[model samples]
Target: MSIGRTDLNLLKVFEAVYEEHNLLLAGKRLHLTQSAVSHALRRLRELVGDELFMRTGKGMVPTGRATAMAPALRDALRRIEDSLGVEPFSPDSSRRRFVIAANDHVTAVIVAPLSRDLQQAAPGIDLVIRPSTRLDLAEQIDLGRIDLAIGIFSQIPPRLNSRTLMSQGESILMRKGHPAARRKLTLRDLTKYPLVTLSVGGQEEGAVGGFIVERGLARQSEMFDRRALEEALRESKQEPRSRVTVPHSLAIPALLRDTQMLAIVPASLAVALAKSGDLVRRAPPYKAGTETLRAVWHGRDAHDAGHAWLLERVAAAARAAEEALG
Candidate 1:
């Protein structure tokens, strides 16, 4: 195949299809229709004189030639991007769209402030946040779909890079007039009140240490330190009586209002939620261990100018959050 004859644009569709393993999904990521994506693939195959992928019951399976070509092709794309993107980003003028992943709590605590900052500094920049707790979050990052993920990630794969935003312990959030909101939270309060905790996935869902290892991606499933909370109760010769479980921190606010349920949540989330004035936060008696909120991204964007600027903004927002609740 002649290098001069190849259309570089087709490489993008190839990369997308290779990552997603499905034509429709690849099209969705590229903002192209299914027929367009298929047409591009057909053209690329004809140009290369090989059928790059095969349709299988499982998904689009790459042929041997395509598999062999992936590494160098990806590196070439990265090199091209780096060369073209090294210029300093002008936030005021750039209309860059960054896709970030975070749980609802971090979205509320971090992304929300970051969005406000961007509005003032870079009016044209847009932020798209996906749930970091999703099982496909790691895959999304691997595929370059998610530019950054901000959340408590216990385990990260080698291909990805991470920067810690803040370290926080657990705080109990309850309605302002709840029976225990008037005073400090005791382990007894944990045992007495029907506790509500966040669990995105669990042992039943093939998760270990609150993380589910799926297709080279270990994502957070259970949101809280359930083991520590349960162990504290067992050490006291008491059995846990967790009455409720919710998938997100945001859900607790509405559930706690006019109720006696207590939620063990990140201190930052508690502080942020307390701003509504309906919730009161207090330190939990048992050690919940420190959870680190981090910004994770694919190594491919390590030096991309726009990505770097967004990261700077994320770090600043984290610092601001820490100060607000410090």
Candidate 2:
């Protein structure tokens, strides 16, 4: 197709459809009616001479040709926007919607405060939080569906950029009156008492090298350092037994309320949960490695004024969380 014959607006519709996989949702994203979006799609399809998307029970699935065209089209659109110059972002007056991806723990520690800050500084803004633990996180960011993601990522592709939010190691949590809560926990205590740990992905999900890789981005699979725990268990000649392995960190308080189970979790989460009178946080018996919480976003937004403003608020919230940890 010749560039002179193609309407640039149609490319925007195509990108939205390819990212959302639903005509109505794509139309909402592009601020167009469904029929208008469909008309644009029809024009683009005729210009490209391909069935770009197939309507299915699930959604609008992209055809092979559409999939092949997506990456370049997205990059080119971003460049065009940059060249055209974005409007000044005034947080006090701009009514904008931003979507972010973050897991439950990060939602609790960082996003919670960020929301409060937004209420005061940018009340007209809306924030939509999606799960960062989804397997297709990188794909979502690449498509511009997610403004940013907050989590621990092992390897980030060059197409994306990241900034560390907080750095923390592992800590153990338990009921205040538990038998072992009176003293410092030892390696033997890990095996003697039933344990509960958080794990988002495991061997069944192709989790290797301590993370799960998708679309060239590697996200942390297990929250703790499994290698360190296993080594410690070997040295003590004790078999490790986790009575409960869960994915959600917020449930730890209820899980340990009246039980003997001890939970190994991120130090920041442990600190937040331990604020309640019933739970106490302790340093892990063995050397639990540290992990950095980072906010990742597409490199194309590096200079976008609105995106930069949101990231600054995110950093401020992270600082508050760090103070709470201390």
Candidate 3:
């Protein structure tokens, strides 16, 4: 059947159910009763000739065909919403919740200041911080699962828009009385200690660990390798020592206290920790090029007033955080 053969309202119900997975929740979101929602789903099934969703133990599960229709349906709905201007976004008056995907370290540095500013400006605004996996950024942004993402992103899908907020180099972090705290961190010194490095799964090529490799200071090491470095007492010519494995940058400061562990982190974060007396920041022994922290959003939201406002605030907060660190 042609697209004209099906009712658009049925597609809306189908899309909501596909996203929420629970009929009751989907119905509540669409302001429809359970029976009405089910009827819409049935109509959709008739039009598509597929059992779009099957009952699962906890909620409905989409069939393969239903899963494939999700993105197109979502995109169409977004376009329709934009065209109708049915609900113009009013940040000061609307109770819209915005979801931002970012790493823990970025959240620690940006969220607090941004939250305070937003609350004072628009008390009704709700902010949700979600964990970001590198692999899901493009998909999440495209599917409207995440409104914006902020971090040192290297791989931005061609369809997305991004702007650099600030650039940062790598630095070493050590606790206040540690031997390395008073000295510069050379490659040899770094290799000598038990290191703690931040890692995120599915990061882009030439991001994160690649910084060290690009500098010729150290080769790319996995989390397990970092752990082996920590356990080895003496370094051998054949087997390189392992360092401590940390997945998030914010954890570095707490781990360095009263231990010989040293961590490499973004200069901005290192400076922030140093100012709080949580850690001492030192230049890395070798030259690691700077990475720019960027604010990214789907191109569809480029002209959106709320999205634009949030981007501006994020940029301002990043600059403030950098200045505070300095």
Give the top-scoring candidate (lDDT).
2
By TM-score, how accurate is candidate 2?
0.86
Give a tens-digit lDDT track for model 1, residues 147-178: 89887766777888889888777788899999
Among all candidates shown, the one with the greatest TM-score: 2
Model 3 vs. true fold: TM: 0.74
Question: What clash pairs does model 1 have?
Answer: 201-221
Q: Give lDDT: candidate 2, residue 310.
A: 98
Ranking by lDDT: 2, 1, 3
Better of 1 and 3 by lDDT: 1
RMSD of each: 4.6, 2.8, 6.2
In order, what lDDT does every prediction score?
Answer: 0.82, 0.88, 0.71
User: What are the TM-scores, per candidate, against the unseen true structure?
Assistant: 0.81, 0.86, 0.74
Q: Model 2 over residues 158-193: C-alpha lDDT tens digits?
A: 999999988889899999999999999998888888
Off by over 4 Å in 2: 17-35, 51-63, 93-96
* Model 2 error, position 90 (Å): 3.4
